[model samples]
Target: MSFGALSDIRIVDLTQMLAGPYGTMMLADHGAEVIKVESPTGDMTRPNGPWHTDDAQKTHGGYFQSVNRNKKSIVLDLKSTDGRDALLALVRDADAITENFRVGVMEKLGLSYETLRQVNPKLVYGTLRGFGDPRTGHSPYAEWPAFDVVAQAMGGIMGITGPGPEHPTKVGPGIGDIVPGMMLAFGVLAAIHHARRTGTGQFVDVSMLDAVLAVCERAVYQHDITGTVPAPLGNGHPFMCPFGQFPAKDGHVTIAAPHQSFFERLCDLIDVPALKDDKRFASPELRGRNREVLEELLAAATSCFTKAELMQRLGGQIPFGPVMQMDEIAEDPHFAARDMIVPVEQPGSARATRIAGVPVKLSETPGGIHSRGPYLGEHTKEILRRAGFTDSHIDRLQAALPA
Candidate 1:
């Protein structure tokens, strides 16, 4: 049964891998009927593994399961005329479709946006690419294939991230893909809304490089306004003092006391109340100017206490928190209270495996994870039947799929 906000919305997902699957996952979690149309071999990530020891049937690994959850899968060989017809049948009733293929892949398959729109004029076609589709705007690097690292570097995040200017580091998570995926989801919803109002749908294009650059907004304005290229400042902020990670007795803790009142309170809690009045740190501008000296002093004081001890001392008084790892986060009461970690019964595993919970909370109609990721072509017959295909037609379609 469908649950969550988008229960009436249907999506034909012709996307695979991290970026596209992630965007559709968000929609599926919110009760969209997401029909994942895959080829005969299935998504490439099905083979990527961090398999559970107890799960012998390794149909999909963690990477695939994590993003493809709460969706149905069907195998379709778009190269075949019958397969293309089947997809078009599904599209006729679908509100939107998403893909992440290269510039010419969809056109080669005879399933371009112009082609799909003919089947359903109200179809919102969303695409995520390294440079973006030509329908939105052409880029010089449109043909260049890119992954997370390439987007991170070319988008300017890597230029101003990491320990120093000499050593640019990629962000730990795949924000390059994930962010663009999120934007695609938002765009799809917006286009769908417009379609409902005016009975016209449009193409939604999101470039991975553009998404990353949008996220690195600070660097853009800083360079344009001040004529200075931004560089990595380690864990510290360019304008704020005492706003980065500091060493504790056991580990690191983050402290952000940039405001005057908060800074004074932080000084008092750390037993260095005199620092609030010091000429080098009396004002926010002065503290930023002499950040190195102030950080050294604060580090000396903070290093004497453990992370837990520091948390206890300044938990609510100032904006402070200990740097948490996965293990710690799993056991934390805050995560439990917020439902940030959810356990679902994995298909092959004897015990339930944990994945992150949905972050969006709606008071009236909340979203959730109702099911685990589907096995390859798990709902093919069911989906085909629902799309008005006869048993004989489904058999023909299945037979035509690549072996």
Candidate 2:
């Protein structure tokens, strides 16, 4: 039972950077055999820093390591016939293949879905495009280069994500890339389920803009609920009072005491019990209506206490948590208890590094980070060998890569 959910599955990951890699990583974490298909240069983030190594040969940095655990690397010079043949051979037995290129990059490689289906009709082909693939719906900006910022700006998140309209801010995390990656992962799984039953695989796609909009779906309904469009509310919730970030003496804390009981509990904790039954702030609706005044009252009390002091009084009494820095999270017992902060082997670095572990825990058949990601083309020979390539064929493919 411990083999895991997707232990029987395999993926040919022809993707680089965040969006595609993150999707494949999700599958890989589920015990799928994820074969990372890379060009000779390897994934772009492999060399970019927050680095742990000084050696050029083993320069895979935090960005690549974070998303690429539990995967194998096989570099291919797709421009070469030998390399292309090697990839096609691998695809013939793979359950799915994923790529995050522009509209026609797969076609340019002569590895379009039509071509691959001939080799393996049961293959689930997934594409994570900037605007989406032409098969789904071609965009006027189909060929435009895009990144996390572009998706956030155009996908409606930036419009309602800051202290004020004039000072809109990008979210700290790369939700544009990561959210699309998450959607693509689910898309791949759904397509695989269908393909397994019907023996006819289909194309699955998710555009960055589409993913961002889906994640920000609340904004759409907000406009529908009221005639007015949504706007930024600083650290406050649109419809809930005492449900946002508040200043502590040391840092900030987020307290979500929006319910009657929770609100009463929070009011007592903050020494504002008089407001618990006050007519103007009695119910959730009234509190929401007078959110500015309510928040100011809470802020006045919260600002007087340190983060630790607030936690001592409010922890577990209401939906309350202090804004934790990385160091605090690292030292936190809860994360350790849940096995969230995991130790990972860093290849060139002398010591291992701690990384965020898989959060979705299962009672049985749990999957995990099997190993650190491989060095550039580290598994090229091994993967080709598994594909039934002869030693001479493998040698030629290796030689095809530019030195």
Candidate 3:
């Protein structure tokens, strides 16, 4: 298996849903052998839809396939003694294990970090929770069940993410889960690095609320430094004028002419050369203070050109972008040139399904989408055999697991 950078590592993934699975996939993308351990019932997303098939009758749908690529699946009924023993055996040689179960679920199952450490002292235990694992500290909401919306609301990202203060909105994607997942991947790598060096491993956790807050830190710092509770200012930035979306003849465009030189150049391109030196908008601070007036002036000029026309005039001279929908992005030459999208062989679909490709390019040892997510318990017997269980033992285990 020529997995990329983490090919030497093995991850026992007990995670379900978006957060934990997303993090495990990051490792899998870089060549780690990720064994996704599911309950007899399997990951909840296996039945989720938006299927790519014409009939939309696929066993697994887009949601599961999107984040779960490059991994294998195995089923273990952890309620049974045989299952627990099997996992302990697998853990004894594994590099890491990750889960998104609530505060005390693992402890109740007797598979807590303390117990797993006894099996594999170098096992890095990573978790994502709405609050956090109790091992770190008991959040008052430790036992409270949460999802992406809860984290976004509590974490301050939603507080400043909408058209205005009265209209705060959740972000378009599940950033609460996704960002924490990304951080957990980094945390696992760090823990594994230290464990390999010192022959010890530790529990690593990320609170979804904490991760969202960290990513939306500008709001926090703004509140602390200036006592100005940051609120959404439509599509523009707080510190820079002429740095947001503006309407064009056909669609929208964005310009980031924050610098004095860039502002002068933008003015020349727009045929409003006098505004570049006007006292009311000559400097960034002045422009910011009078952004309302400047935007009205800029919007009037920009509304004359189509998006493509603006791109032609201002694309290279200053920071500029066309507001691209997915259909446009699918045909964009830049994305194709960079390989930002690729195809994976999905089972139910007649042909391969396209998913976003790896953006973190490493020229010499680049990571990639290696394979599609496995079928439910697709490698159960194979994995048990690898764990030193004989065919007879595997037969017993499979019988105990749900078919």
> Can you give the lDDT of residue 380 in candidate 3?
86
Ranking by lDDT: 1, 3, 2
Clash number for every model? Answer: 0, 0, 1
lDDT of each: 0.92, 0.88, 0.90
Model 3 lDDT tens row, 1-403: 6858889999999998998898888889888999999998899999887777463458667789888999999999887899999999889889999999988898899999999998999999999999998778888999998899999999998888888879889998999889999999999999999999999999999999889999988888889999988987888889999899899999999999988999999999988898987899978999999999999999999999998899989999999999998999999999999888888887867777788887778777788998988889998888888999999998888887766
State model 1's lDDT.
0.92
Best by TM-score: 1
Stretches of candidate 1 exceeding 4 Å from the true structure: none
Tell me the tens digit of each residue's lDDT in model 2 across 14-122: 9899999999998988899899998888899988767655534456677888899889899888877877888899999999999998888778989999999899999
Per-residue lDDT tens digits for candidate 1, residues 190-294, read 999999999998899999999999999999999999999999989999999989999999999999999999999999999998898899898999999999999
lDDT of 2 at 36: 97
Better of 1 and 2 by lDDT: 1
Best by lDDT: 1
**Candidate 3 whole-model C-alpha lDDT, 0 to 1:** 0.90
- Tell me the deviation in Å of residue 66 in model 1: 0.9
Better of 2 and 3 by lDDT: 3
